[model samples]
Target: MTAGNTGRKRPTISDVARRAGVTKGAVSRALNSGTGVSTGTRERIRLAAVELGWSPSYAARALNGKPLGTIGLVVRRSPEILDFDAFFPSFLSGIESVLSGEEHATVIRFVPDAQTEAATYERLFGDRFVDGFLVTDLRVDDERPAMLHRLGAPAVVVGAPEGSSDLPTITNDAEEAIRGLVRRFADAGHRRIAHVQGDRHMLHALQRRRHWEQAMGEFGLEPGPVEHGGYTIVGGAQATERILARSGDERPTAVFYGSDLMAIGGYSVLGEAGLAIPADVAVAGFDDIPLASFASPPMTTVRSKHRALGSAGARILLDMLKGQAPPLSTVLTGELCIRDSSGDPV
Candidate 1:
């Protein structure tokens, strides 16, 4: 006869310590920064915490006049973008991977415009809701690094190097990957290679476009028609339609999109136009997301380490919070994934 269990109280750090056969101080050191704890003991404490379903309370920390064990991430994008844009999900998962081990929480906020975005940051830091921030989507003439500095808020930028700011950055260098993609197309005898880029306001989008143009010039090929896709599937489709509007010899034989979502959208437009992928026109994209592999003919794209970028950025932020100086910049490499969509994966 088993009793029905209900109204059970939440587990605490004490329970975790008891379960792991360690003292509460050991639990604190293990979860906070592993300062005075051994690796084996830390792992044992973490497993105990997980088993006990115990996580530190940010509210409790705040009440105790301690730094909130919280990390802030404010994304300046429509909420709908989070649904289809694969980068955010993977990046966030990476951040969680590190933060969870440290018993920290992430505060995510979405804003529709720059004004609202800036205000959100101010409010979050000003109110002590978060100890630090993880900034993303580096823009042209970005003001976030300087703004955060003024507020004396610790932060780590998760994108390309910002010449105007000295904040630590975790970036994925995709220039060579983009160039390699272009070279692959050229080697496959593609002369007119077009590109569908994201918003020019974003540094990443601008960088991708630049890489494509430079790679085209390097191959002694005239760059094909270029269009802005806004990093959306619908935008990709519309851009593809415009690209196809060109006359016979001017039309591109291969198209490289700045994102997999755009390339997937381009797929639909190509299908409706009765064009066979890799048979009539080759296709490629950046960010080799899960769907890229499942794409009808599969997609050839650049695999940027979005998860690694997030995890690395989180680590740097944690180090900053601990009064440690992290490197000014950390760059991860991107890989060009060859798939069937790009002319027999050559």
Candidate 2:
């Protein structure tokens, strides 16, 4: 008999089996892998579950050697920092698009420091709270990968670090992106191009900083000032303030911020100093966020698909869960978007 629709408990595997006229064991196999079941029968069972609004419980599924239908994201930052950073939301949306189709849920946790971050990962894995992890905001010499490996947990990292092995990584090459921006500044007759960098601990931040240095040297121009601003408005503002404090002929004529947040923050400082973009001091940034175009002079930036990274990272984890040996890594490339902030469109 089919379970009543008015019950407190959700429709179970039995309900789907009853509605599809299949055995409970068959229902389990169809939902999990559909290996032994015919295509038509699998479709029928899936449709029945949809009609009955039935979903397998993560806890119940875990007991039977199935994925727990959940993914974990442990961020080593406070909630305030997360709220201020636009990349997180956009990235998460991309990840969710794939997870939603797979009928999986994401569990995000915020921790303050490295110790706490490691502890949280250990606790989650030891308790079987997640099937796998989506690791982001990687740092220099990050221990999370090693820790996860020792625990035998599956994970996908969003950034690539030198000498990293075992875990799969998704990365975008910023070398050409930075080279293009520096050339833009040089073509506009800018001799001094300063950079407001993100946290030095992050691999991407270091990559951007190194590219800036190399591009400047290659162009035969003196490398301008480098200030650590991190990826926050306040951090960017302070870094810009320091750059602006220099005397005539000592300050930079153009500034390349590590992220769009830093670029927007620098914009506020320029406004306070009565400096106009591309006229007094040109500006450019990474991660062309939604607000980049809306800024006073429309900030120039690099368009790295944050959503694509999220989706790709999740797909790698899914492959691992299925016991497939996916490629060791995936590298994405970015494009430079010129705007009024960096002079005329190029």
lDDT of each: 0.90, 0.89
Query: Lowest lDDT 10-mer window, candidate 1?
Result: 1-10
Top lDDT model: 1
Q: Looking at candidate 1, what is the lDDT of residue 128?
A: 87
- lDDT of candidate 1 at residue 60, scale 0 to 100: 84
lDDT by residue for model 2 (76-95), tens: 87777657676688789989
TM-score of each: 0.87, 0.94
Predicted candidate 1 versus true structure: per-residue lDDT over 113-227, tens digit per residue: 9999999999998888999999999899899988998988999988874474668888888889888888888888899999999987999999889889999999899989899
RMSD of 1: 3.9
How much is the lDDT of residue 176 in candidate 2?
92
> RMSD of each candidate?
3.9, 2.7
Best by TM-score: 2
